[model samples]
Target: MMPKFTHIENDRAKMVDISGKGEVVREATAAGKIFLRPETLKAIREGTVMKGNVLATARVAATLAVKNTASIIPMCHPIPISSISVDFTDCEGYIEAVVVVKMTGRTGVEMEALTGVSVALLTVWDMVKSAEKDAAGQYPVTAITDIRVVEKKKGK
Candidate 1:
C-alpha cells in the first residue's frame, strides 16, 4: 500500500499521524560537496574566507539546522533529536560535508540530516562568495549532491 499523507486527494494536505506508531531510534546521514575554484580552495585552506572559519561556522550551522528541521519543513513532526554531528573533508577541488542526525521518535529524521547538509553547504558558499565571484560578479554556485540516509536501526 502507498504511504499515507504522501498525496493530497483533492486539495487537502494531510499530515502524517504518528499517534499509534512506536518510537524507534532512527539515524540519518547526508553528504554534499562544494566545488570551488583553485583560488577559492586556497583561500579556505589559508583561513581567509570572509574573516571567519568557514568549516567551523558551517558545522555549527548544520547542527542548528538539524534542531530546527521540523520548523522549516511543513508536515514533519518535531522530533527530539539526540545528537547532530557535522564534518567536512578537503577533497582536491571540492569540500565535502556530511551531517549525521540521531533521534528516537515515531518519525524519521531524514529531513534533519538533509537540512543540515544543505545549510552547511550554503554557509560555505556564503562565506566564500566574495572570493569566488564570477566575472559578472555573481556568487559562485554550490551544489548539494549525494544526499541519502546512510543507516537506520529500528527499535524492537
Candidate 2:
C-alpha cells in the first residue's frame, strides 16, 4: 500500500521509490504524425529543406529525447536505456515518427517513447516551418497529432 502511494507524501509530490522492485526487460513504442502542406512534404522528400536533412535531424533529436526523458519530464527515473530506434514514414500531407525505447529497469519506458515521438515531430516542424508558412508568414496547415504509446511490454 505504501509503495502504491509513494508519489504522495504529506500532501506534497515526491518521486516514487522503486528501489526494491525487480529489474526486467522493458520496451515501449510510440508514434505521432505532423501534418503539413504538400509543397512542404515535397521539399522534405527531395532533401531540399533549408535546415538540411529533416529526417536525419529528427532521428537524432528523437534519440536524444529518449535518452534525456527523465531530465525533461520530472518524476521519471533516470534509467539505463539499452536501445532506441527511431523510424519515420512520409505520407500524403504528413510525416509520421515512430520511436522505440528499451531498457532493463523496474518501470516501463512508455514515457520515454512518447517523449521521443513528440520531440521528433516537433523537430520536423522546426526544420520545415519555413516551407510550411503561407503568404501571411503563418503555419496554417502545420500541426502535430496522434502522439501515443503504440505498445509497451515487460520481461520479454
Leading candidate by lDDT: 2
| lDDT of each residue in 51-80, candidate 2, tens digit only | 999999999999999999999999998999
Using all chains and alpha carbons, the TM-scores for the candidates as numbered come to 0.87, 0.91
After best superposition, candidate 2 residue 60: deviation in angstroms? 0.2
**Candidate 2 to truth, TM:** 0.91
TM-score of 1: 0.87
The true-structure Cα RMSD of candidate 1 reads 5.1
Model 2, runs deviating above 4 Å: 1-11
Cα error, residue 131 of model 1, in Å, equals 0.8
